[model samples]
Target chain A: MKLSLSSSPHQRVKRDTGQVMRMVIYAMIPGMIAQSLFFGWGMLIQSVIAVISALVFEGLILYLRNRPIERTLTDYSAVLTGLLIAISIPPTLPWWMTVTGVFFAIAVAKQVYGGLGFNIFNPAMIAYVVLLISFPAAMSLWLPPTTHAGITPSFFDSFSLIFTGFTTSGYDVTQLKTIADGVTMATPLDTLKTGLTQGVTYSESLTKPIFDGGFFEAAGAGWGIVSIAYLLGGLYLWKTRIISWHIPGGMLISVFVCASLLHLVNADYYASPLFHLFNGAVMVGAFFIATDPVSASTTPKGRIIFGAAIGFWIVIIRTFGGYPDAVAFAVIIMNMAVPLIDYYTRPRVYGKNADKGRGKY
Target chain B: MTDFRDLSLQGLWKNNPALVQLLGLCPLLAVTATFINGLGLGLATMLVLIGSNVTVSLVRNLVRNEIRIPVFVMIIAAFVTIIQLIMNAFTYELYLALGIFIPLIVTNCAIIGRAEAFASKNGPLASAYDGLMMGLGFTAVLVILGGMREILGAGTLLAGADRLFGPIAENWTVVLFSTENPFLLAVLPPGAFLGMGLLIAIKNIIDAKIAAQQTVTTEKAARVRVTAES
Candidate 1:
């Protein structure tokens, strides 16, 4: 084969920050579509509100900081962050809350910490945590997926509910939470947590209607499909080399291992591995959120350890902690550990002692 | 010895314990949830500062250098107890509201810092003035932070004023607005931190502006008659 003269990096992919960010946004479309289909149109509405507000806030902050607003905004990182936030929050969250969350994500969480790559914690997760803490009542008001709910809000209804806190047909999110069977429904993780707290066995809790008639037996209705879509999108990213497999791979394996070990010890108290994998934010979190390059572990080995730790915390917190979903909390906690992980897991240099190497390596 | 004017200026503006020196942050952050709570704690802290400063200055000559720290702490503890007892008697609700922080005033670094740095080398009158001015500075910050948090978190100012003042101040709460959900983050401990950071930033900005103005004037003054006017 004929060789062309080039230094070091012989193979190059024609991709910049804007391209990578666009790819990530493209990858998230599947998850967004699934979310909107399963939940009402509220997810789409919330996403639009979040993305617009995120761009506005990001631009404002950039302008105030005397940086190039157009170039940074074009990178689409803010859009992805806003989308991730919209996915994580309850679809029926009020519009103003979505705006406020986006503002905090862009301005305080991202810009205040020196913007984009310099942010220590993932801005989306920080905004999610802040919104979760600040508005617990509104944040928890999730509706049953359209499959179970008797009345699915139309696009107009979703828009109306977000803007005015009531649907066009005069139904509030709480009222819309009622399923066809006249029982108000929470998410599967929430249902399981509440059941476990009330001394109901895990197996008995699985028999709840939220879990009984789902498409997947292990994961509940709509959520399992949504998770599967995210997994497919994640697989695409993996195939395209947009993300490495270590972080997601380690996170999934560790989650399965932890849940299985606990489930094996006592089937009645603990949920199975599949439930842990396909429910909550595990699929999305492991693939998309935990793989955030800025706040995640940099070295390959460190990435694995970081992912595994987050996985363990997810299972632990979801099972024992007060919160039903653990992904946002888990990701934020792991982000704090990334620098330490990267520092200790630095790769050894060639022609140098691995143990003693400190300077460039 | 420093003049009263210089001492007052240093204590109040130049060398603020809460903002500049960053001393006694534990009480500054913890008890400043409302204006009344902050005011109550600030007053108690000021009393301890004054009492300890006066006492430490009086005994500065007798106490050996090796044992001065212990002596200063003991004096501060005594004053803290005195303030605690007084608050318990007159403002029992406020005392209960403050709880452990009243006794914790003894641990406030600003008190012992003044004792060791200022009172030990200064006359009683100067030390007393320093204490009063420093106390006022610390109290001003507490009041500002507390008021900011209260207005943001609860949409009211001087809420529960009766806790600090007598029952006659029951209606002192000025409601700025009412909402179903006030910003809960502002009431939390993290809010205290963010508010404190903002206050520090504001102070720095003001200082920078003053420095810039002074430089411009000095530059004008330093302009010599290099070229005699044509």
Candidate 2:
């Protein structure tokens, strides 16, 4: 028997799960580094814990189900989940919170939904939201930038703080923030929320130490650098064709347009487009979390709609809702609408007669 | 005798009122934020279930089939009212915490469902036992779910135990870990749903594993018998 070579159309692109997941992991590195730099090493340690736990859980579940564990483990989807969870959490969260989030992300979100492509909700976002609502205090504990603190946690301290809840200095991670002039340090967004509630004008609140050198109002110092890095990584993915431009592009545009409109109406109340763009997980969410293959819309048009809806909802919830951050909630809400969006936005095949028009058929 | 066991098993697992039957879910999901809370409600439910079941069974032979549904509902409502008043008097804090859910217990389909389906048809002893087992099963799940949520949400167990069990349980909360930041999501409604889902998934998985093991053993035994015959 002779083995024949096929032509271009017959020869497929040769993509595998491992390759796709690897690209995603690669795309996440710049953002991970930025998180480590700004938030301190807690995120990095959490990432490590999450990644290891996810892989172990994934493997265990696969073993229980009698699936090919090694092959599935190599795909790096578990790694992506870890990265997402790490970035979403407070850098100073305790070890068990990390473990619990990973456990839920893998066991409940992924495995119980039949694993990988079958999960209806974004596993990482669901875990993050669950942790956030369940542990509000831990979830909201953000330290000021290292520049303000005069103390940056060493990599080892970061590790210790996350696991043991105390740095080598005997100070708990929550106590390490700068307290100058009787003012406690807070994240720029948190500061803004509290300030606004206290009737502080947006521009006046911008003078707070947390926003000292930050590029835009309400953007945490050093956070914009991370956002920019994530944007760069997202652009690289788009350039390399690793991800389509529809979802990210649509999400950015919608957020920009919406924030602009809100700012135009009342600049005093609403944050600027730049503030919305460069702050709290907006860029990371636009490019990474919202683009999950399973939970996102399948069709090109649907992807755009899904992305825009998430952006729209984020703005609405952030501006008016109780939570300081709305990315996770927005993503989960949009996840539920993906199927409906895909159904309505499906492209018609060439030369195929149009289906019955509304009630006419 | 096996019939009794099967009935108990059916109420507890196979036809669980809260899970499979999806009856009494409102209260089950709402108040199950701690083990003691779940236990409190579950015990209250058991009282109502038993009282209603016995009353319905006694009147089952006297009432016409056409009006049996209304009669059963009234009996369940009456028992629920009695249970609510007693709880309000004894466990005021818990009663306040449970609030609408206690009265809403009147609408708990599990109580009415037993009255209509089992209690109205079965003998008094069986009916009462069924109600007791079903209520206990429901309470057991509630406590487990509540414990899971409380532990995850507040890093404590039996938080505010005094609310349900009174002063002995005051400060009975065992802190699993003390963090300035408690997980707020676990105590929230969404967490309740997630915890409940995990519980259901766990039950299903155990059932699946047992079924698979049974199938394997039966297959092996059948093959051995066939080879011996040959």
Best candidate, lDDT? 1
Model 2 bad stretches (over 4 Å): A1-12, A180-182, A216-220, A354-361, B1-6, B61-67, B123-125, B151-185, B205-230
Cα lDDT tens digits, model 1, A62-151, are: 998999999999999999999999999998888888888888788888998999899999999988988888888888888888877888
**Candidate 1 structure quality by residue, lDDT tens digits, B1-230:** 56888878787888999999999999999988899999999888898898899999999999999999988999999999899999999999999989999999989999999999999999899889999999999999999999999998899999989987899999999999998767888888988998999999899989999999999988887686346662
Question: With candidate 1 superimposed using the best TM-score fit, by how many Å does residue A318's alpha carbon deviate from the native?
Answer: 1.1
Task: Report the lDDT tens digits of candidate 2 across residue range A25-85.
Answer: 8888888787777778788778888899999999999999999999889988998998889
Q: Could you give the DockQ of candidate 1?
A: 0.76
TM-score of 1: 0.95
Residue B133 of model 1 has an lDDT of 93
lDDT of 1 at A317: 94
Interface RMSD of each: 0.9, 1.9
Worst 10 residues of 2 chain B by lDDT: B221-230
User: Once superposed on the true structure, which residue ranges of model 1 sit more than 4 Å away at CA?
Assistant: A1-6, A354-361, B225-230
